[model samples]
Target chain A: MKIVLCVKQVPDTSDIKWTENNTIQREGLESIINPYDVYAFESALRLKNKYKNVNISALTMGPKQAEGMLRKLIAIGVDDAVLLSDKKFAGADTFATAKTIAAAIKSKLSDFDLIVCGQFAIDGDTAQTGPSIANFLDIPQVTYVKEVVGYEDGYLTVIRELDSGFEKVRVKLPALICVLQGEFEPVRARINGIIHSQQVEIPVYGIDDIGLSVEDAGLKGSPTYVNKAYRAPQKETECVFVESCEELAECIKKCGGICE
Target chain B: MSKGILVYSEITSDDYLHTVVFELANKAVELSKKMEDAPVMALVLTKPDLINEYKEAFQKSGFDKVFYVVDERFGTYRTDLFAKAAVQAVKQIDPEIMLVGATCQGRDLAPRISTALGTGLTADCTGLDILENGKFAATRPTFGGQLMATILCKKYPQMASVRPKVFKPSEVDVTRDTVFIKMSVDLDDYVPQIEVLEFTKKLVCDLNDLDSAKIIVAGGKGMKNAEGFALLKKLADKLGGCVGASRVAVEMGLAPQAVQIGQTGKTVSPKLYIACGISGALQHTIGMNSAEKIIAINTDKNAPIFDICDYGIVGDAFEIIPKLLEL
Candidate 1:
């Protein structure tokens, strides 16, 4: 069985600082593999470790700089890595994103049986890509997944997380599953694995390579656009001081606030 | 002619409408009154037998029209199928505005319907109002919960997904009545690519259910470590309350995500909310601002949490919590 894990290289949101021009200062801030995608990568690695016949492949779309993330995934135990890098793929939203990814998967149609991705990208938090990709592929999608029960001949049992609770779901082979963050802890990198990944060659695919027109890959294909981005005004509130134990008790009593 | 506002009524596991459904109903009525005697319409996907159980609740909550799709396949939420049915219904009924709760199901269904109808959708709105020209002005937090922005859709049947607990539900009117409209759809034509095989509930800690708790004791980054959280638990247990946390506390791994109270987390409205060692960022305060009474305990007297708090303690939470636990 061959598993394809969709990963992304995103700006570390925690470290993002704004410049005077209201744009993100990507300078000095390091880029890493999206945290949620790590869970998907770990899940794929676990499957490979359990089954000797299983092979895991890493796939991502971003600038050429994203090749570093793919290399890191290869270091962590993936067998092959592919980068969908091109200026035409810039500014694509979830819909266009799913299209490009589906096209990439189709190019390797013979060997792939399952596809996995993180539940959502932290930067967007839209949680639309996985389902949209499933729709494009015309396959069943299980989202907010916590664990995989087991895989049979052509069906896989899995557990999905709902707002109130969870339910057991089963989807056939050739399906998409989005794993939630912290679903499973990642494996520690070994010395041999790191050396092997450094020596491995990663293939890059552009617009023509994927058989997609430049118009269908990027800003032109995206339906939703961020018209403008600005910071929200902050609301002001007054702070009060409570000095002594007596003052604290009096404040609690006068305010009728929480206390035993 | 007065225009009617529609709400997509979502169902809970207990076979009742989710609380947000009635909240939206109350909001719809408010919006409808602005349109000269318009009525609020509720669209439910359920069986005929189930409709009877929810009809009175809808009427009591201010629904003037109860439009329903009664079918077995409608029991579970399927986005494409529901969107197809809802789009068809809206085209026939012709509502001026549509409101949906920003729950997981709503987040999935609203966009699909909006896209299919070629309308605009404003998601996770914190505020809503009718402009002078009678357009829906929706306000929502953006940029990782740092700012609030108001937006207007250029298209008709303006749709918005309201965050739950942002609005209050109206008092039930037992004397009220409603008009029930039963609608049917062919489920065989729509096939869902995603199938729900099974669901497993995560194990929630005993201290996590703070929303329903009468007393809620929450700690923040100021609590410092696990020992501080343990102290908070003792106080919560003594006060017969549950423990809650700020986003900082959750990020620090001192508490679980379920107990997080903030803009991105659960919005809680308990009777009494105790903030221990919390500085009270605006995002956290928005979630707990509706609580009946608030008591803030932090070492920094100038911490922002004191402003919204009904009571303030400028002492260390490490000292206050332990003393309170003994009492």
Candidate 2:
């Protein structure tokens, strides 16, 4: 079975800082694999460890620096890696990003059975790219997946997380699943895996290499554009400070806290 | 060009109209006014028996018209099935603007619909409005709530999935003759791509249900232990609300990860959010700052929580909460 893991490199949102003028200052922030994508990779690796002849390929679309992150995935457990690197792919919204990714998969990894992606990226946090990719490929997609319960006979059972609860569904291959971040322990890269990564050839695909025109690869392909960007307003509350809990409880009551 | 404003009225697993539908309806009314009173409409896909449940909501919420498609397979949500039906509805109606609630299910469905239509969709929008040129503008938080961007879509169906509760529902029911139109779509040739085997609803009144809670009492690393959380839980119970946690508190196991409220977790807009022992980082505060009222209790007088709270107490949550719970 062949699985493609769609991963992204994002700024570590936790380490992002703010300037004195209330603007985001990301100059010194480090870029790392999106935290949710790690969970997705873990899910894929679990299948490989449990089953036989399961190969996982890591794919990403970003600047050439993204090749480093893909190599890291190789050391962890990925069978191979593909970097869809091109200046034309930068700044594309989910629409264009999905087009570029689906194009690469069709042109390069066309025979793949499944694609797994993190439910969201910390930088975009759109949670749209995964499903959009599935749409562009004309395949089924399941989002907010918590677990891959079981897989047999070309079918995989997944537990999807909902706003209210969880639903387990059995979906066939040629599908895409976006997984939520779950509580997972770190998976260390084996020494042998590290040695192999050093010798492995990471293939790079450009806009033309993926059968995409420059117009269909980047901002030109994107339908949405940022009109204005600013700091979110901090609504002034004129917060009244109180010394005692009695006043706090009184205020809570006035705010309609208690209800039948 | 598109003519009307359309909202995807989602029916949840509980077999009821998701509250976000009414919330979107309320916002849609305003946007319609801005669009020279463009008609406000709704689209629903559900089983035949469950079809009528949303009518009163549509009427009272001031929806001008409703278009629905029913099939037995709609008993539960299947992305393949729903998206197919919704895409058909969009083609049939050809609305100028489409709004979807950014709940887990809506987020799962919106992109597929937008991509199928070859249009743009702005995700998790906190604000929606019309520009001077009449293009739809969606304002949303980007880079994990660190920066806000006003986005514009240059395609048809100016689609956006709005964050729930950002716009409040109407206070009074509006009496409108909402026209109901039943649209026909044949799925006999359609085959199910996925089979739902089991479902487990989260426990009712779960402390993690911050989205619908009227009030929430959340804690942070200052909530040092189970004992601190126990105090928070007590206050939450006293207020008939729920308990939420900062990512640090969840990491420390003071609260379950399900209840973690931050940039990476659930965004809530409860009526009152009592932030105890929390120093409001932008990541944490952005999730709850939309609450109508917020009160914070911490030992540090200059905690950032005070910057966004409606009330502040520069003292211990331990001492303050116990007394508040006693009331």
Best by lDDT: 2
Q: After superposition, how far is residue A31 of candidate 2 from its true place, in Å?
A: 1.1
lDDT digits (tens) for residues B212-323 of candidate 1: 6777889999899999999988877766788999977886779865677876566788877889999887668767877877888988877778777877778888887666
Provide TM-scores for the models. Answer: 0.81, 0.94
The A-chain TM-scores of all the candidates are 0.91, 0.92
- Measured by TM-score, how close is model 2 to the native structure? 0.94
> DockQ numbers for every candidate?
0.26, 0.67
Q: Please list the residue runs of candidate 2 whose C-alpha ends up more than 4 Å from where it truly belongs after superposition.
A: A17-26, A241-260, B205-208, B224-228, B248-258, B299-301, B314-327
Write candidate 1's Cα lDDT for A1-260 as tens digits: 88989998866655557788766676987777777788788877777877668888889999998888887888778888889988899988666787788888887543688899987665555566776676666565677666777777777677765566776777777888888644465577788779978998888998888788876677776654444455545444344565666566555445444456
B-chain TM-score of model 1: 0.89
Candidate 2 lDDT over residue span B115-219, tens digit each? 999899998888889887888999988776778999998888989998776788999877589999999875656778888999998988553677778889899
